[model samples]
Structures are given as structure tokens and as C-alpha cells.
Target: MTASVLDCISLSYQPLWGKARSLTGLALFVQPLAEPPVPGPIDARALLETIGETLPADGPPLFVVPQSKALLLDTLAAVEPPPAPGAPGPRFATRGAATPTVVVPSFLLQDDSLVATGVRLGRDRGLKLVWQGSADAPPADDIRDGFHRYWLDLPPPWAAAALKDATRKAAVGQQIGPGRLPPGHIYGGIESRVLMEYCLDRCKALALAGWPGEDVVYSLRHQAMQPSHAVVMATLKAVESDRSAETVERILSEDPLLVYRFLVYANSPALGLRNPIESVRHGMMMLGIETIRTWLGQQVPYASREPALRPVNAQLVLRARLMDRLLDAGIEEALRREVSLCGLFSGLDLLLNEPLGVLLPRLRLSRRVQDATIMRTGPYGPSLEVALALESSDPSGVQALCAAHEMEPGRVNRALLDVLSEVDPDGPTI
Candidate 1:
């Protein structure tokens, strides 16, 4: 496709967790990059087909269509099944055989006709429906039980807090009635509320049991697993300032591991090194300050001695790479570097079991970087938000963040895919 045409289509996937926090499903999203300067009805079917073609062969099965393209579901429903081999049949009837679940905004449920049509289509094709609701207008009673209702508007952190509050209430309810509480009493009469609360507590307890805690975080950052403090601090200082090669080398030589890793990375196949890196100075001369800084930033996670932190480190690198790639071309090189730092440090709190407010100051990060990473309030904030939103299963949240930043969802999706491909070439589609 031409650049202009390619720019029109953007696709990304969100992971859905099952009861055990296992990845049970994948929700695919195709968002239009343009905001339609001139408002008009979009060609939903054509767009859907285009999106389907762009997806990887082993990409997610569930596809989320924006409410603006509600007609796409209708189009799928109208498709006829193929005839028997011996019978004369329409050539196009065999298409639309895939019965991937179609998730739409809950507001669409307000339309009875659309809901009825969707139900009929779902039943006919063995498809499923998921309604994503906003805080202002959740799913209605009549349709709530029939489909999945994912609450949006609130970010993942806020949603988690709300769930914790609910879990607490449910614990109290459990104390009121030890035995099996009556059904239909949940959130209704006093008895029902108590029973419902108890059930909620039980569910929350079961879920939390499988989750990792501060101990895991602490273990990952154990003294043995920690990187060379002097080398790390020196590298940070070198990257923050326009230090000379002699300064950079002196700092790197303080730690043998730092020197070894830098040499290995500088000569790695990915860098396509023409000659072997003889020393830190040689690598610095061959790769420039910015490249070296980025390389050092990525090394932080890999430096961990704990094998379990490999996945976490990979995720941080992926986020940093994706954020760097998604940055607008107009962004200054320095700001881009800061944005990359923000992405790398975004998860440090979970990694080190320490708040960013404490960690960032220790690193002497610039005020802008500190604000973006800790407070999520700086020029790079939107980029970080976009990165986090890309990891979310909520399409509404992703769309809202993209819109707010005037970012093209397609571009963000493309950047994410590129980063994943580079980071984990053999891994499954994310």
C-alpha cells in the first residue's frame, strides 16, 4: 500500500485474562488514523475487510469494531452460508465464515433493533458479543447477563483500586453470614447485600492468592541481583551530561560486568558491527552518545542477576522502544531521549519495590523526566499514557487517549508491532 493509504489503517491487540490470570483471549482493534475533517458515514465493511487483511495470520480472533461502524456487524449477519457441493450456490456465500466475537460499545445496546440483530447474527454464526460500557452509561439489565460488560472510562490503576474496595466490602459481608448466602440477595435487601459481599470477598481472595507481592519484587532486587551501583550511577551521569569518551570509559571500567556487557552489545549481530569493539572508548567512538545512552538504558534490566526478571526486563525494553518509535518526528532529540528514559523507568517502582518519587531523585533525573515518570504530567506524559493504553484491553480507553494526544492509533499500533518483532521475534503475537 502507498504511505497515504497505509496511514489510514491502524491495528493493535489487547490481552484478555481468564479466571486464573491466564491469557484466554485476544481483542483486536482497528482504528482509523484520520479524524474525518469532513464528517460523513464511513464504509464500515470495506474498512473491516482491510483490517482483517492487515492482521497477522495467527493474530487474535476477537475483533473490536467501533460503534461508528456498527453496520459492519449487520453486514456480517446478512452473509449467507455456502450451499452443498452438488448444489448451485452463490460464489460469495462462503465468505464471512469466521465467527470471531465482535465487541462494541455499550451505548449501542440502547438500540433494541441493533441488539436484536446482533443476537440473531451471533446465534446463527456461533459468534459472541461483548459490550464495553462507560462509567456514565453501563450495560442495561436486559442485556447485561447476555454479554460481557467491560467498564471503561477509568484507567487500570483506578479500576484496580475500585476492585480492592469492593473486595473489602465483600469481606465484611462474609462475616455477617458464614454459610451459603441466599441468591438474588446481592446488592438488594440487607441479607442479599451481605451474601453478595461475602461472595465478592471469596472471589477477590482467590484472585489475589495467585498474584505476586512485594516479596517477589524484593527478591528481584536482592543484593546479588542488583547491578553495580557505581557503574550505574556513573553511566547515568554520563548519559545526562555531554561527557567525553574518556569520562564514559573511566566510569564503565569501574565495573567489569558493565564493560563486558557494553562490548558484547556493541558487537552484537543486531548492531551490524564492522569491527570488534576493542574497548569502551572504541564502542563510544563507533556508536555516538545517544545510541550509547539508549543501549545503557536497555542494559539496566538485563543486568539483573535474577532469571525471573527476564520477562519484566523484556517488557520494559519493549515499552521503551515502542515509545521511542511512536514519537512524532517533530519532537526534539533531547525530549525523545527523555521520553525513552520515562518508558524504561515507568515500571521501576514495581521492579525495585520503591516509589519513583524516591528512585528518580536518587538518579538525578531532570525535572521533566521526573514529572513524566512519577507524576505523569509532562510533554512526555501523553506518550507514556499511549504506551500504557496500548497494553490495555479497553478499546475506549485507547481511543480516548489517542484522540486526546492527536495521535494516530494506526501509527501507535505499527510502532508496537515493530518493537515486539524486534524484541521477541519468535514470540506469539502480543
Candidate 2:
């Protein structure tokens, strides 16, 4: 059989942070799901090619592939680069022109012969080697001279906290001298445990600090204010029309703050504008009605008087974009719009301190959108579940939702990666 097993595999990337919290590398893991129905030895070349196709062309050069023995022996062994100039080697070009530095598990060094062969082949093909240590495979002194770099794998449960500690240690290590311990030395099991405990304490503190409690929600709603209902209605209406210059201008006139924010966003570095937007009419023409619609929709929920809600607002925008991308190519245009709305409104109860049953009616959303957001049972509900699953880092939940909706994990991951870039092109994707 052809290597259809490769289709079942998915890549999950974890970002490695440096001293300044900058992206130093990416750790790629092949999520070990249930075996494909037509199981045999997976075609290593095909699996690598499939993964290569899914990765962004401009991603980081350092890749930490999984340390599975099968992958080490079959996959890495088979990944050969193009032949050197006027010399004999593999004819086919792998993935792309960039030869990534592959970080394998330290256990591979246990077999000295394998290490020698793999290192020689990797060097010849321009692939540098780094060694990663895990709980099961600790670093060995024998392999110390084989690789130039070393990384420790953080256990999944404490990964976030460990990464934070590691970043802090790295930052401090940069400023200290000979007596000080470096980041590498501080990122071991004991440090991770301490960081994890600290993280738990911080989480408890945040929980008690009025984040999602009803009191906090109520306080936020009482203090927060949104744009005028008339302006909102007019803007929504303008979005449906062919030429809305007059409507848009009137709305801008009513709310100068809206005008200022719109101009700022339009002219922001993210949009890469050559000339400044001079008027609402200019913005309308340049950004188009749909872009303006989405922007306006985002502003309504996010324009809170309380500064604490800023992060919440950002999260709402992220959810909307994520849902939009996830539903791409899968639903009708109108349904896609509704799905985006559902995502935006999913947090309405928390944002407004009112039940969605009471709050959604005010927005005059469609019955299906209301059902999906409030009850979580409708055509759009499954997509929302998938989005939430991803947000919560629940892989099993995400897989179940994806399977129920006939969505491919690879496509979902690709969609998520694209949305992440769109949301924060310059920020690290973690």
C-alpha cells in the first residue's frame, strides 16, 4: 500500500524561548495517535515530505524532531539532501532549499555506530545536530563531544511554567558572572517543580483576583460602555450597502474616538500603509465594507471602559479570527460570517455579566448563531468546541471534535498557524 499512514500524522510545534524571551528554536513532535488502519512500516520519506509540505516556508531553521527509535532509524536515515556540485549524491531535493538543524534525542548516542553514521551524513548534507535530553533519556558524558548544543524537554504538565522559569533564568544569566548558574543549569527537574508550584500559586491568586467571577464581570459591565446603539446600527447598515461614504462619515463625526482608532489601525505598521488614511471615506474605499464590518464588530465587544478587559477583548478577536479560518472552505459565505459572529459572542455572558439568553437577543443575531453560542448545539457548535479545545490545549478534545466534524487535524493545524501569524505576525507563536 501507498504511505497513507503519513496522512494520519500531525505535527505540533513548541517554541523555544531565549534569554530575552525571543524565539530561539522550535520543538516539533509527531503526535502519536492511533495507528492508521492500513498499518505497516510507515514510509519515512513520504512522512517527512508530508510534514515538510505542511510547514511554513519561513519558519525557524532549528527543528527538534521526535526521539522515537523508529523515526531515528528510518526517517532521519532516509532524509538525504541534494547532491553536492559536480559530485554524486541524492538527486531529489528535500522539502525546500533551507537545511534545518535537527535536534534528536540523546539516546541516539547510545549506539556509537549509529551516532557516527548519522552525524557524518547530517554534516555532509548541511544538517547540524543538537542533542535534547528527556526524563527517560538523560544526557550522557560520552555524547558531550558529539553535539554542540543541548536542550531539556519540559514535561507537558509543567511546560508553560518551566518555560517561564527558563526564560527568566536565561535573562538573569546574561547579566551575571562566573559564580552564577546559567539557564541550562537552572532548567532541570528541581527548578521545574519550584516553578510549577509558583505557577499554581499565581493561578490561584488570579482566580481570586476577580478574573471570571460574577462579581468581577458585574463590576466590569457597570463601568464599561459601548458605542451608541444608533451609530452601531448605522455602521452595520452601511456595511450592507454599495456606497456607504455618507454613513461612515456620519458615524465618524458622531464618535471621534472611533475615527482616531480606525485611522490608527489602518495606518498601523501591521497593515503596511504607504500613505496615511485622511478620512472615513478613504478608509471605507481602501479597507472595503467587509473589512470595516469585521472591524466594527470587533470594536463593539472590545470597547470596554475598564482596562482589565483589554486582554479579554484581544482574546475575543483571536477567537473570531480562529473560527473564521477554521470554517474556511468548509461552509457557505453567509454561514462563515455567522460562525465568526458565534465566536465573537461566545464570551458575551462573561463580557456583559448577563446570561447569553438575555444578552444575545439585544444583538439581534440569527437563531442558529444564538443557539451555537448559548447552548453549544448547532452546525457551528462543533467548530466552536474545536476552537475552545485548541484554546484550552486539550488535544483529545480537539481530536474528538475534529473527527466528529470530519475535519483533518493537519488542515486544522495549518489554519491555526495561519491565524496565529495574522493575529500577531511579529510575536512568537506558542
Evaluate all candidate structures by whole-model CA lDDT and list the values in order.
0.52, 0.52
Query: What C-alpha lDDT does candidate 1 achieve relative to the native structure?
Result: 0.52
Candidate 2's C-alpha lDDT?
0.52
lDDT of 1 by residue, 252-371 (tens): 643434544566677777888777554456678899888988877776764544333333444454566667888887987656656776776787777656688986665434687788
TM-score, model 1 to reference: 0.49
Worst 10 residues of 2 by lDDT: 203-212
Over 88-196, each residue of candidate 2 has an lDDT whose tens digit, in order, gives 5442224352334466666656666776566656655554466666533555554455454555434665565444543454355365222212233213232232342
lDDT of 1 at 178: 32
List the candidate 1 regions with Cα displacement exceeding 4 Å.
1-13, 18-24, 29-35, 60-62, 65-100, 104-107, 126-318, 329-338, 364-371, 375-379, 391-410, 413-430
Residue 43 of model 1, lDDT score: 47
Q: Could you tell me the lDDT of residue 405 within candidate 1?
A: 85
* RMSD, every candidate, angstroms: 12.0, 11.6
How far off is residue 236 in model 2, in Å? 19
